[model samples]
Target chain A: MNIISFLNILLPFGYAVAVYAYGKAFFADTPWAKSSKRWILLSVIGTHIVYLAARTTAFSHPPATTVYEVLTLLAFTTSAAYYVIESRTGNRETGYFILNIPFFFQLVSSLFIKDLLEVPEILRSNYFGFHVTAALAGYSAITLSAVYGFLYLMLYHEIKQTRFGAVYRKLPSLENLERMSVMAIWLAFFFLAAAMLAGVVWLPQAFSDFSYADPKLIGTVFIWLLYGAALAARRSTRWKGRKMMIVAISGFVISIFSLTAVNMLLSGFHRFN
Target chain B: MNLLCLSISHHTAPVEVRERLWLSPEEIVKTLPETLRLGCSEAVLFSTCNRTELYAVTDGRLPHESLIRELIKQKNAGSVVHESHFSVYRGPEAAGHLFRVASGIESMVLGDVQILMQVKEGYQLAVNAGTAGFFLHHLFPSAFHTGKRSRTETTIGTGAVSVGYAAVELAERIFENLRKKTALVIGAGETAKLTAKHLRGKNIGSLTITNRTQNRADQLARVLECSTIPFDRFRESLADADIVIASVRVDTHILTADDVARALEHRHTGALFLVDIGVPRNIDPAAGKLENVFLYDIDTLTAMVDENVHKRRAQIPAVERIVADELHSLELWHASLQSTPTIQALTAMMETIRKGEVEKNINRFGEKDRELVELVTKRIVNKILHTPIAYMRNGHDAGPTERLLSVNVIRRIFGLDHDNAKRDDDA
Candidate 1:
């Protein structure tokens, strides 16, 4: 009915159109279709920014209280990250695969738009805001790394099998995909470390009885260690190509589990409404 | 007016015959004017390693066979190719052939891109020599447009089909990005140098050249601005390289299965692509079975090239459709030119009759009335001629015989042929 509500309905539809356009461009290999996909994506991001700005203004805090709100925020961060990587690499062929994540999250967010809730006092700190934003960005980067890893393995198998089908012609070179995955992993490691630092600093102030037994805290530490090991292996060991790709992909799966299972199914101080 | 093309390509003539008929730049310069003198109003001579084509336009004054024979005789006094060996096409077929040639459909190597540049050069030479007239000036641009459309719209020019290019393409497939990958050339022979040049063009991270003769390797390295490693120490560099090109002239295998297995163990990561372009196969065929080692001998590379060539060949039907579309448009233009002389004579006759009648009626009226009468008579003549002029210009798409019959009837009724002949003589 209002601007925020209208944008809530429009954002998912916009993503749907962009996804369709990107898929068409990927298959048809038309420059015009690709350009249209880019413009549509930019406009969707614009609308998302407006919606988030309005929600924050109305609530007197960032939209980090509810599941739908976090989903919406994740959608925005993931799309932004994809835009940056796609621009840097000049590789748009992976858009259809990568954009699907944000599309699904945005759709879910829109479906639960009526469930917007007020933030609790402890969750409204600047430290909490920084932690949530950084964590989302890290998760988005890890997701991208996983996507590239999957593409690399697929192309590698296709080449090894000598199928030489659409995948062989359309996918980026295996080396390029590997490089992109490594770059994404590095970005993910940096942001995840920042989020952990922010969370550790905020713990003493926000909780009267902060403990190491919290599921969210334990999951976050586990993911950090796993990715750290992956990065260390990449730098030190001769574990590259398929081994490195598998590491990145598994790291993404663990991050997703921590984000969903540890936050909802398990009791933690980081739980949302 | 008529357009004609006389061509002898690798398909129609043997190499000896093509060599005899080939035209050098100096020969084209010397013989182009002679070709024009033989009643060719315009001409473009295109000569490449695989083909030599002469596309010409004439005013229907000289026979096409005589013009072709005289030109061939000038190039080779004792011509081995009979006139029949030179395929001839007239009218729209001639335009279609030029389009096909420009678009690389007629290339010995399917979708070879070099011929497009050669076509542009030939057209430029014809223009500079003052042999290109209205028809050729229009034809060349349309042909170029068709060539560009076919390439962009189809997958005819997508992959690498030559041996040197195939090596580079395979490297890209293995590593995805060559900018961060190193390449090692095994010998200082022509194939090795060519493969190194192709790799360099891809902006590889580094290039190392090694040969049995250190002096030759250094010479080549200096030219390529790359480093030269000792021939014996080349195996040390192999562990660091992403691509190894073995083109040495040794009868024995330069790289054995055990050697590559050792290198693979040392280089624990990434795939090592070995291209054995040498005849006796420098890399052992068994080495290809080793883990993370990809060895492609000459036969394997040739098979890849053949596969790519077949892919390009599959695109010929699409290119031919483009050629046919262009030819149709060109035919409409050419047909428009056919009715020009008749239209000009008809307009000239009408103007003369209007002026003569105006002079005879001048004395029957006062000065003001005579001026008004002249204007009215001029308008009447133009009004009467408008339908016929419009019909002539717009009727170009009609059947040729029917259009010719209509033109003949108009000329008979208006007596335009005599006027046109007389006007030509006066001019």
Candidate 2:
């Protein structure tokens, strides 16, 4: 079979394995807890590598030519971020669901978008790789962190209710989740800032007139500020647990809207349309 | 033996009762043996600020119910206890409960993480007191193993954890390198003291402790190897401090906008960070609105701590799986205990039958020639018992019953288990 057909099959199979493995890791009575998750992680990475190779081979160029390629790259970033957060936080359960869902979309997107599509002239730049990759990486990490934060908040509520039995038995210590989310947000902040910085630096040379407040630009900045606020709130404000989780989730939502919705709809300088 | 656990934790009982019931290591050593003498084979006393639990594995013949009641009555003489005063789980269930407890599954704060060490300490205390017998020795190590397994294998022990650690994390965010930073603790209360200790552990270049009682501040300072400042000089110290943790009990906002603005004038442009851990609030919320000023109140910190608390909660299933996996091996060992003696008795009976058969058979061969035959018979018996005995000891079979039953087919060949005719029906 052709590479597209292979990827179409392999990618979805990987996603299925990831979901099943993650579920087994979360609920099984055996050593599948670690092994299953590790297998899923390996499968995702393997599939992504294959997908990248196929895309690169098909395009006869690097895989950053169109929105589809960027989406594919973003899928890889999300998986990478999820694994990093999972290892760092040691939180395999909550993060599993968050990590698996992104691949589902990426896999679906890939199946249909495999026929080489032409990119808008504005999209064909070396800076495109830096911008899309950084933003998505940041976005993925933020989403993972947001999930961790939500778990933290739920556990905190359970503790407050004075009903610490079954659910309490399953969660990580609150302090660990809080620390992990903070770390995730901080890492995302660094990447997002880098992405914005790259865009702004390259804007003047690339385009005749680059608006300072392009929708994507403005949205990206808003996410940066929101994350900055989260960091500040956590720092001087001592923002933790539920509050931190809410902020993380909110920040991820903003990122999604900025990166996807705004780019698809509004006639902004950065829109794919 | 009666195995019981009498506990007043952050659950059924409040902090006051828990603290009152708390016992030190010295106290555990003194009390454990006495508690065991009251009718237990093993006694492990776990007492911490958040919980006080007494776990005992005793003779099954002991009056487990009244014995625990009397112990609690003696311990909590003046205290009010209803019918639901303490929870009592028995047998394998008790073992499972304690395993979970040691694994931090039964913590009041849901993955508090310190209970495992405390459980270990309690086990050690029982061992030291000579109250932990073979059963307890086997049981406690399993519990410790389970705790370790749970912590390592599961996400329950992972993520944004620790309130004090989180506080330090927030502080680090303000000043990336704490080694060059100065930290000011504004109270001598538990939270403040803990925050100070966490900061100290982080090696924040200079630590200045300030409390209403200068002596308390000095005491912490000595322990932390830092200096102390007067409570009145808190505002004055704020400017020099790169991180300020306000843990004092003040009804009003101690650090006002003007106070922070003044501190900012003397502070490095991006350095100063403020944390208010006081209940009625310490630093004014409005101070955060000021340029280059970052202020966090107690409510905010608590919120952060709570959020992380939730995330860790989500990881509980993974941690529990770790605990359960380790507990599986332990259960196998425990179940083996039930059938071990039966296997031993069966093996002994079979060996006796084999020697008897050899003696009977050798009489026809004459004395000198029979010696070699006796040696051969003994060697045969040893060979026959080796695999089954080894497997049973490793907790494979219900004992040698299955192997011995199979050997009935070769009864004439090995001449084993003649007495098994009597015990077979009973077995």
Candidate 3:
């Protein structure tokens, strides 16, 4: 197989091993697993970077040209976002929870992905690249917030219920999880806002069929507003611990629905399937 | 040569007796040099609240009892603890003892996080006193390696193993930074004071203590150097607290579900961590059911402490295996030290015999013939010694104990053991 195909196969395989390594380190605390997990994750990230650059250069258009290609890029950006978080916090305990998303995303993307030899000239626009990158970053941040929210809730339940089992033993503290989730939500808001700004400024000028009332655009804006109000709301009426976590999770659900249903069912210039 | 560890610990002696044998830093400095005069080559003493272990490397000139007697005499602990309270481990067993102590398997509290540091301090004391030498130089690092491995490889050192730290742990579980959080301590009882101390150890931002009697609350606040709220105003202050430790000695619940729910309504805090460690329990059970309110009574904290202790206990076998592996590695390295001295002694004996015969026969020959006889005799001894030296160099597969035995065999075979040679001479 060519380098791209080999990387396509290696992406899921590499991530699977990293997941296992991180899981073993978290549960069993094996010496080898604890030592090797970070290096394995680093190698996988390196390979993923190479694969993305190669795929763009090989196809004459960026991977964001199609939904399937964007899935592959999403997988990369999500894992990349997690890498940044893990590196900064010096905590590798939550990697298994985070890496599983990209693992599955890459698996699906690799299976259905096609080589697009021809594309519209606008697909090569630097504005489109910025818009897609910002959108992917926004989605990745949303995924991080959702995962941290889920972990926060699990640990919260474990503490409140007095189980004090694996969820309590392994996961980060509720306060830390809350901070991470809020930070991610704030990050997602800015990125999605930027993506929307790019779309508004360029879509009306570039495409003949571009409409201001596209379903995808409306859905993204709705997600952006939901998180925006939650993060920026008043202190006395503000959502903090449990209420804030639930809002973050719900926002992620809405984003997923927008990504899947709105793109598949609705017709618009945003749908590039 | 032998490395010996003489231990008087909580396991073998009561705390009253162990305390009598405990050595202060000044006492250890004064007593450490006396070990060398007592016929030991090297010495290190681990004297903590629970254990007082004296590690010495002796040349088998002094018996273990005399060393034990000297230690007991040094402490003036004759009437306090009998000699039987001391547990003696020699050779590899002594190395194993040091490893277990460093790894916290022999600690009174299952995973003694501070014991490793204590071990380091003991080793450092020996180093400063110029007591530890060749053998200890290798053995203590192995013990340290064992300690590090046990902590990293197993979950022994993780979690709050002490029941008293449950409140602090729960606070940590809820909040990211304790420096930004405020804790309201209800009541001035012992449990409340202890919980306050625990929070203080974590450096809580603000501490507001309340008691039924305002004077007692002021006294405790002064001691802890925090503020005090009136007993009646404590409920109002609850809305501002991120953590409420209700350890009041009350017959009825001080915090009810309604009170907590009302506080949470006005609170923009992370979560309400209620640690009720009072007799007759201070917080209502229904308070735990409220959203964003986590109430842990004494029973729950005790249960978590018990489980954490069990988790640490379960890691003992793994830790022991690490100890054994490191001890074996050390012994093998020590066994390698054995061959060099043995080879030198053997060669010296052979050379002595060769020189004596050549001197007696030199007059019977010419000068040139005498030189020829000397060269022939030296070559013959060299050929005889080659096999044993080669065997010693190539014997890496020998296990720890077996390697030591093999070294003994070589000594006995070459008559390098002084005791055997003296015995043979007397016969």
lDDT of 3 at A214: 90
Winner of 1 and 2 under TM-score: 1
Which residue runs does candidate 1 get wrong by more than 4 Å?
Answer: A115-117, B65-70, B73-82, B176-180, B187-232, B247-253, B256-258, B264-270, B276-293, B297-303, B337-348, B355-415, B425-427
Residue A88, model 2, lDDT: 72
Candidate 2 segments exceeding 4 Å error: A12-43, A54-105, A114-273, B1-115, B122-133, B146-182, B189-191, B194-206, B212-216, B230-233, B236-243, B247-252, B261-281, B288-335, B350-427
Candidate 1 versus the native: TM-score?
Answer: 0.89
In terms of lDDT, the poorest run of 10 residues in model 3 chain A is: A231-240
lDDT of 2 by residue, B35-68 (tens): 7667777777778787777777766766656655
- Write the candidate numbers in order of decreasing DockQ: 3, 1, 2
Please compute and give the TM-score of the first chain of candidate 1 against the native first chain: 0.94
Which lDDT tens digits does candidate 2 get at residues A1-273? 887667766776776677777666665534765566776676777778877777656755557665666667767777777777778766666545665666766766666565564655555566866776787788777877787777766765654443444446555656567667777898899889988888888876777768887888898889899889878866675355456778888888887888778878877556653
**Candidates 2 and 3, the one with greater lDDT:** 3
At residue A151, candidate 3 shows an lDDT of 95
DockQ of 1: 0.59
Per-structure clash totals for the candidates: 0, 45, 0
TM-score of each: 0.89, 0.53, 0.90
Which 10 consecutive residues of model 2 chain B have the lowest summed lDDT?
B398-407
* DockQ of predictions, in order shown: 0.59, 0.03, 0.74
